[model samples]
Target: MSTTADRTPTRHTAGVFDIRTIIGTLLGIYGIILTAMGLLGDPAYDRTGGVNANLIAGIALLVAGLVFLAWAKARPVVVDERELARGDDGNAVHEAR
Candidate 1:
């Protein structure tokens, strides 16, 4: 006799393993580093026509990273334990033959 809880699907979020999360984290880290360099380090205006490339790029990366993180937070990937357990076996083709 299965209870209501037992019949319900066991689901969980992809968490840190999600691609968006990984990308967001990496971008955010790099953004911070670049932004710091642009602010404190020497900004050679000669190479980029007086434009602070590091600062501009860092800000852009930060914004993109935030967007990705927000997207992942808003719509997380859910995984069902039942589905994972029911994954196809390698012998399926052999059996069908």
Candidate 2:
């Protein structure tokens, strides 16, 4: 006799270890640093043809990071305990050849 609890499946999500999360975090950090430098440091107009390279790059990185983070949040990876427990034969117990 199986109870409701026994029938229920166990699941978990990939949180910090998710690739998107890692990428997003890295991009965000770089963005903040670059953005700061762009604002505080010299623009070096001669190098980039008068364009604020650091500022532009920093903003781009920030936007990309946000997008990655949002994507990760919207679609989280789910891991099912039961699926992991299954053997090649699709059963909990492995069959001997």
Candidate 3:
């Protein structure tokens, strides 16, 4: 049986969380909340001009969410062997045999 260490080391590229992705996720949640409130006949309607606020917010969230999702999916997550090989000083030091 091959152990995890013996197996190929998965590359973990740094760009896991992007600003746009985080913003999109938060907006999505906010939009969902507004949508739910609007649909559930919450008092938010009275404060706002009309139900359009919720509708627009929801649509915007859905669109942004999809876009962010696509971007996150498209960006490749690669394990950087070169970076790993390079030490903190950006130099590869090999021990003398």
Maximum-TM-score candidate: 1
Q: Write the per-residue lDDT of candidate 1 for residues 28-93, one digit (tens) a residue.
A: 999999899899988989998999999999999999999999988888887776767777643211
TM-scores, each model vs. reference: 0.88, 0.85, 0.54
Residue 32's lDDT in candidate 1: 93
lDDT of 2 by residue, 1-97 (tens): 9999888877777778789899999999999999998999999999999999999999999999999999888888776667667744444322112
lDDT score, residue 35, model 2?
98
Error of 2 at 11 (Å): 0.9
Error of 2 at 87 (Å): 5.1
Order of all candidates by lDDT, from best down to worst? 2, 1, 3
Q: Is candidate 2 or candidate 3 better by lDDT?
A: 2
Report the lDDT tens digits of candidate 3 across residue range 1-97.
Answer: 8887655643564354555567668877877877776566554656776555766677777788778766655663444454566545443321222
Model 2's TM-score against the true structure: 0.85
Best by lDDT: 2
Off by over 4 Å in 2: 87-97
Candidate 2 Cα deviation (angstroms), residue 46:
0.3
